[model samples]
Target: MHPTIAAAEGLVIDWTQMPTYNTIMSVAAGAGLLTVVWLARALQLGKPARLEGYAVAFGVLGTILTLTGAHMTLTWPLAKYFPFDNIIFGEPSLGFGVLLLGSAVLLWRRRELPETEDRARELAAVIAPLNIIIVGLGLALGAIAFAGLIFQLFAAPPEEPISGAFAQWPWVEATFMSGMFGVTGIGAVLFPLALRGYRAGAPRTAWQWIVGICIGLPGLGFFLFGALNFFTHVGLIINTMGS
Candidate 1:
């Protein structure tokens, strides 16, 4: 067993409320993904008219993620079973949430722009200077993803009861979660390049495609996983009650 779970062996938890965390984080991830998709489409079509809507959506999602992530990071609420989860899930969410919120403000301020193409250029220009920070975040995420993958493969292996129905297919659960991290890492690493390409009027560029796929896939996965957990958690509650 993982050390954290081992440490938390005797503690009783209310599984019913656990899904709330999953739901909130997943919604934030999904909304952010949708925002990115919309922004990409707008940029591709050179339409800035709808940028304000995207900005509003991003701001809301970002706020939700930021608050939740901050609380998780500071409190380490899951320390009992998965302490590292605080770092793996919380830190990235916080960082990315702040980025989204900031970007929303920037986009909102420039909503009067006539062309999405120009907006992209301006955004790219603003972010270009932060390449170092972006790269650092990418590296951190990559390291976290790699570590999480290793832990999932060799440590507890997700066979614990917390895995619920997935307890039988530990490797699948491991791969799915780790894969989400890996893709999100890749997206962060390639984000600057993708933005630069988009700004240069190359919406169809490879970097852009790769980044979009990486980010969008994880977004969908988080959303689906969270949604699935809601039902699974209810089943768990029923089973516990029946027993």
Candidate 2:
């Protein structure tokens, strides 16, 4: 009854009874998948000098992850701060994923030239201001979250469980705390720089740097967290399910 592939496919556990480590890693995997997909699409679009295409798609991916993660009990700071729900149903997350994916697909379909400079200019002008606003907001909020995480590292424990697994494995707490900063920090900082490079299109120096910082480092963080979680807690998850 271990949580092997078959077990995961067929296992049945009440939502409320699921452990915190399982929820954290599961949500991380989903979010990471979205990031990878968006990164691939961005690279393809950027090759054709379609910076706006990539920007819009990347924005959609990030927007969905941030807003949806803030709502999901597994990933949200609110879930830890409040007490109403632990693991909300996955339907809403799935719906948002589909909406963002569909948006990306539509953008991909229209990646070719519009045959009119006026049209392209109009779209770029509109998106430029929006990009600045979105990236600015992301940076501000990420800084706030990073600060909160730091405070938690040193503060007294709450009577309620901020992270249940932290009691058993302190690394679990670090995983969530550092992972949040890594994900959000990378996105907020690197994205604006990437967009600027995308727009410049001259020395062609920005694209690789953008991809490296934005995708590579965050990806490494996710992979590290996943490895650590598996090594430290996968057996526990399997055993809990079997029991």
Candidate 3:
């Protein structure tokens, strides 16, 4: 089973199947634009509107989708045998590319739905802050993603059937995916809690509880992940330079 093979798509291809044109642009646009829109709303820079909320939500999702596609690309070297190889190239563009573009376009087009002051206040006082934080973390993740893109471009081509710890390391991929899940998974676990929070009359607070856990606390995990990555990389650099 080729790691790049897609039983879903019914064919296979290499991870570097094509240039990063479509996938990279889509992901980056999602993260970067959405982050901007969210931060603006959070800071009260614009009129209270659904566009702001929508932007942030799509942005984080875009960032996640891009990360998934990017990681899947690593299978070329990492895979013992990629099962989805045929599907990778045969079907179409990289994973979720078209859907993302369509969603972004639709989101942009549908920004002006009629709503009430009550809803505006709710978006402003509640979802903006939390969504801002989520989008901001997404922006950070997108930046880290550049490392992989650079590796694909400037670094020497992997040894045919690339070897070394990187080729075999599942933890690297798992860590990235886990980080994304930990942040958004809260929403899945606490949908009813979120609805309750929304309905309980959007009182702004330093912490919002969702599904029995404080939202602010779970939110901190994304920052912690970034700090850990920075220090780890810095330590590795210092050790290498010393050697």
lDDT tens digits, residues 14-75, model 3?
A: 43342222223333433433343343333232345566466556655555555545555554
> Ranking by TM-score, best first?
1, 2, 3
lDDT of 3: 0.37
lDDT pick, better of 2 and 3: 2
Per-residue lDDT tens digits of candidate 1, residues 126-145? 76766676677778878876
Q: What is the Å distance of residue 74 in model 2 from its true position? A: 11
Candidate 2, 188: how far from true, in Å? 1.8
Off by over 4 Å in 1: 1-20, 153-163, 200-203, 237-243
* Candidate 2: regions farther than 4 A off: 1-15, 19-106, 114-133, 140-148, 151-180, 197-201, 204-212, 223-234, 239-243
What's the residue-level lDDT of 143 in candidate 2? 56
TM-score of 2: 0.46
